[model samples]
Target: MKVYGVVAAFWLSLASATILQNGQVRPNDYPSTAISAISSYNSSWHTYSPGSPELSYKGRWDHKYISWWSAPGLKFGFQADQVAISFGKYTSDGVLVAYRLGGQDWMLTNVTANSTHLFVTPSTTGYNLTTPTNVTQTLELRVTNWAYGVQIQCVHISGGAAKLVKIPDYTRTMELIGDSLSAGQYATLEGISSYSWGLLYGLGNVEFSITAYPGICLHEGRCYSNLHGQTAQWLKIPDTSGRALDIYGSDLADIPNWDFAAHPAADITVINIGTNDNNTANNVTATGYYNSYIQLINEIHTRWPQSQIIVISLWSGFSQVGNTWQQGAGFLDEIQNVVKYFNNGSLNGRGECSSCFVYYFNTTGILEHSDIGPLYHPTDVGHVKLASHLMQYIKLTFGWILEQTGPEVQHDTLYWNDEADY
Candidate 1:
């Protein structure tokens, strides 16, 4: 892959078409459009150039939900009767295109890949863009696959040219690190419009990243031999075997590591692990788990010194295969003890990181009552519940105000009265 410095001309070449601004067609000489890695965007995982503008490498671990480009002044152009998007090297079975039109809520549309250069006319699901023409809108796009990648070359409008504007940088950034639950494995099983908790939590102005894999565990040599040693593995790009591939080859062999310096550090990092660690087949002891947990936290602190790390408690639902409810409780207890140990300065050596915290959200009510998907994974409703609980926790812990309201909770009368198993 080619590496380019942060030069002005690099960003300018992306805008190949003219845009309308302030009721006038701006000259075609402006920069193509601002294309930068924001939230979950990572440049190392894919390849890009002028010829194959948005091509991505094909491999097992290359799957990711990368944010391609953000156009800020979309509201400036004439009301588009139709919008056309072009993609290159499209390999995914299907890709989800999410965008916010005008001031309305974010909408999801799925585009099926047909060939190398695929053109798609997405359905305007939520807000009608045909009636409104003179409003400013911000557009963001993300790929849905966690193992395959896609490239978005450009977007066009039917009525008038789209005015490319600067992408807005949020005041705070948050990162969620965990396994399938945090990755929204089955949130969309019910429907394509379903959203993950990470996306819902980042609804408004908060930039966020979801670094997770479905079957990943906290320790190595489990479920999949390709798993990494700790949760920190997701911070880097993975190879075919799910191992962290060296970011720079040959010349940088001595410094073979992901250049985290290129990515923005998190202000609040929430970790939800241990579900896979509790596997009976893994035979991991309580002491071993605690040591691994603390090591992961230390690594996170080293990466983002200013980050407030929040270690989430294991969601109280299912234990690993062959484990009973009592064993699951014990696992949760061990995790709680580990959190206390770190908070009390017993593990950190240095005094406790006052900003660090632990939060518990009981999943028993949601999962045991069938308010979830197959394998007891949280469905759309369950994700919303998790997000709502986390939002309240964030408000109380950090005193941060909600920038936007999340999706409305869908309560099922049948399961509303079910007793929580945990």
Candidate 2:
């Protein structure tokens, strides 16, 4: 597939127009002689660009890098025992990435500009991944934190691109839009702890893209940085760009306009925002929330008009005082109006509302009173609960059934341990 080149903006719209029929896992592509070498013993290395269709992007492609913690990064199969990749040519130093063969514990690597790294071999120190009997092995790469982004310049396979294999059987694409809760703030491997990741990891077949940023309000204002925040209606690049420039010292610019058509239009798009807007600090009026949300939904519909939109009311770790947990700010009530206004025709005095295929799920009391964590976000355990609840809702609402059970043991626990310092 000609995955790159923005010259023809036509394909961009088409990608967003393509939606998966139903949620389904990719069929496993195990050859009859699974363990047999697919190439001659004399292996020659070959390089392929990030847009090479040979790569299986389990994560969202910003058209340059696999971003956000929802699906974290990319994964692909290689016939060689070893591989090398330039994860970042434009990214600055000190960006950490974790990668491992399927069924292996994550191994960490730090990146600098245009750095090339080889897969850790079995005999190498600190290498704990299993050496499968099969020659073709799949490598899963993910960013270690949300404060930064990882870009793949090119990948070098030992044999050739001909040996590259798809991850197989993935049926649907979902774009997750939210604030810190979806960003996995305060949890280990932040994005991985989000409800979006929870749903994707639990369901197993859906490809997910996260549009979450910590501290962002749906109505927009100062959030993660002093510059601007990603609002429900005006988001193109995620708000993480602020963190990228401030904290990581990366040479990057906020993408002027995110290419909506870079990936297939989402089959399902979930919106979990409003915490920052209705909080006592922001106290953004209901009128502002209603108009902003109406515009956001209308914009999403225009891009992926056929996709289903799921809007979830906000949740939080309420502040505790005098042995009493304060009730939440009632953001869900306001969010419900956002949903109601869409289906009932735009009631917002703002111009208009596009026709929306939307559903509003009340997540007011999703977490146990005990599941809230610091920063008023869900704890690792609470994320599990939120993901589970949403998955059930999707299954019943869309008639989506799973072909396999997940998340494997690796996915269940934190990718980081106390011994390792990120």
Candidate 3:
């Protein structure tokens, strides 16, 4: 196992004005009504810079163009019959971006390299962005899917190009930490983005910061000789090497530290790791994993005392062993054991200790055979299934369910890739 001791410097963008204030959306983030929306339409494309306060940002850094790991997104209001977007693509055609405008149903489309993708909000029962329908329309977009590298420029409003007034409304936030199962694979159709999207639509008012990559582990040391542990990656931005580095940077030395104080502490943090630790050739022991995870838990506690940390086991259990119980040959038991240690062997530990910060949910049989993708990870179908169950769990345990249940997935573009092993 290789040890990494180098601490990367922090990179805080001066241009990220759309930043979260005190880890929460600034009240009435939208611009004052003193500056009215453009009542008339424009024949030319009206452009705005990404740093414009009119644009609200979350789960991302401020840059000339925005791109990073997990689901970096925006929420803003505008007046336009059509919207055109341009983005920078490093390797693959930046695709699988999810969007909703004019309160319409969610739509999925690919933002091809060096090209402008035009989006026309369809006429739903309540929404129609056209001249007669409404004076202003709000747009919510998230690059739930990552395609190697992406740099999103500004949006161009064709007709009613009003100043983008970003409005963020959320009661709490969630931080999802994991590896390939959490981060989509190379050119994967949709990462666990659907899961986050499901939570967004179902819960109605919450935010998610996805701190995950293709091949990471919870314990230190290494996995695939590249992925560093969560302790290292959590504080840095993701690079192109299936790792986290500065978005413009190319190597580990250029990795930039993420500012936790600038962002909000997670009300709920879901940790799904350990698969790589067990699968790696390093032959990590459960004791080693136990210690490392304890470290992770300790850090989380120190950062957010009132946070609920849910540790989940790997979905893909190893090959059937002994015929007694069909599951993986990895650290599923040990992972749960660590949770039990904190819970004092009591399944309902919260009742015993009001301050108990840890909880465990065994996902041994979460995914069905068909839902499992080729890489031994959950496919789009599998992700939705997983999200549904997670939502159900949160509702039952903490009574946090809202009106909506799940996102309306785009059937045509529904194959997302994930997971990896030698």
Candidate 4:
């Protein structure tokens, strides 16, 4: 896996306050005031005040690709033409910003790391807003990039007068943990795992967190170093260094650990791992893998006592080590046995978690050789299929109300064609 470094750069200054599009320049203005990151409307993993407009930090390893902060049911008093956001970084693969205006569907746009200031208007470069103006409206924005950390300073509105209003309380909360698939490594255009799943589960009114990284494993160490050791232990930490601070290094202060109390405990925690552990290089035995996985689940239970642990079977095509798949069938069977053992109250190593369950998804149709590249990461279509299957399981298990007819379609014009396999 490639290590990411902090770039010392600044955003390009806007030549004009208003954006020019389709031969017309709209009037624009900076928000009269800003919302502090600590406000209830702004929900994130870490709270740090770097400067003005207190920032919310999202560590690189904690929720790289699919982590998001949203303000739902925000009522604007007057017509607002555009929204601007300020971030700490401005580079490539920076962040994907999606918003839902009023009662309409959600729309998506990309935010680069080169520019700390992001301006989104009806006549924005990539997407156009369809919600009617000059009326009370609600907006929600989600971050989609997973490579580096981001600190969202504040959200700004322009064009007309408006004020930030209270958002309704969410009924349920969720947390997702895994490796590259969950971190959205290859599927750059429209495949942040949590985004796809959020749409599938109709999670507009739910608060959620995604904790994952590329090439991380359950039993084996991280993709980069063997010293990292086990996904469970790493989950407790804050950031994983791509450079000086690693498992082998003696740098302790460089890497910081996370505080579990920063965010509220989730109602449901879905874990999708073991793909890297099943790799031929890891050489993990069935017994070792099972024991390590059970230990990880127990740790999760202990951390979030009220959460319902749902272990997802690894998707197919990830076990290809040589001419044939390495741990495709056998590893799945082992995982099933582990789940059964936990459910039957046989392996209660860490206190019994009665709500623990297993979800075995059929990945035959979703993970096709053509869909995934040589590295075995899922494409946008593959992610959508995975989300569909997981959505079915959530509906059957929790009986969540299906508000929409189908999954929300994302219209993204900025597609990444040359993403490197980590």
Cα lDDT computed for each candidate against the true fold:
0.45, 0.60, 0.58, 0.48
**Model 4 residue 370 CA deviation in Å:** 4.7
lDDT of 3 by residue, 114-231 (tens): 5555554344233443552346667766665542445656666665444455676576888877766666432123443355445534565677776665555677755553446776
Candidate 3 wrong stretches, greater than 4 Å = 1-43, 62-64, 88-92, 112-115, 121-134, 184-188, 192-201, 239-253, 318-325, 344-353, 405-422
Q: What would the per-residue lDDT of candidate 1 be over residues 273-302, giving only the tens digit for each residue?
A: 766666565566777777777777777778
Clash count, candidate 2: 6
Ranking under TM-score, best-scoring first?
A: 3, 2, 4, 1
lDDT of 2 by residue, 1-422 (tens): 01112211321322231212123332322122111121342256567888877687655445556454333677887655456677565553555566767656555566556566766334433233434334556777776455566678887665322356666736787888876678765555566556677686567667767767665677756533313444532345434444344433432243435667766778988888776666545556888877778878888889898899888866545666787765454555567676667668443322124554788776656765577653355667788888888889888777788534532422435445677656
Which scores higher on lDDT, 2 or 3? Answer: 2
| Residue 217 CA displacement from its true place in model 2, Å | 1.6
Which 10-residue span in candidate 4 carries the lowest summed lDDT?
1-10
TM-score of each candidate structure, all chains considered together? 0.63, 0.73, 0.75, 0.64
By TM-score, who's the top model here? 3
lDDT of 4 by residue, 1-422 (tens): 11111110101211123333223563333222223333343332222222322222322223222122121111222235555554544223434454445544555544544233433456543333434244545555545444433444344555544333335445677777765667665453323443334442354455555665555567745444423444434444533323213222434444445567766677777777776666655566778889887787777777788777667666546444678543244377777776677677443433224455543443444555555543456655566666766666666666776554543444332346686875
| Pairs of residues at least 3 apart in sequence or in different chains that clash in candidate 2 | 16-265, 25-169, 26-168, 26-169, 26-170, 27-169
Off by over 4 Å in 1: 1-83, 103-108, 112-135, 156-161, 189-203, 238-258, 316-327, 345-368, 372-374, 405-422
Which one wins by TM-score: 2 or 3? 3
Estimate the TM-score for candidate 4.
0.64
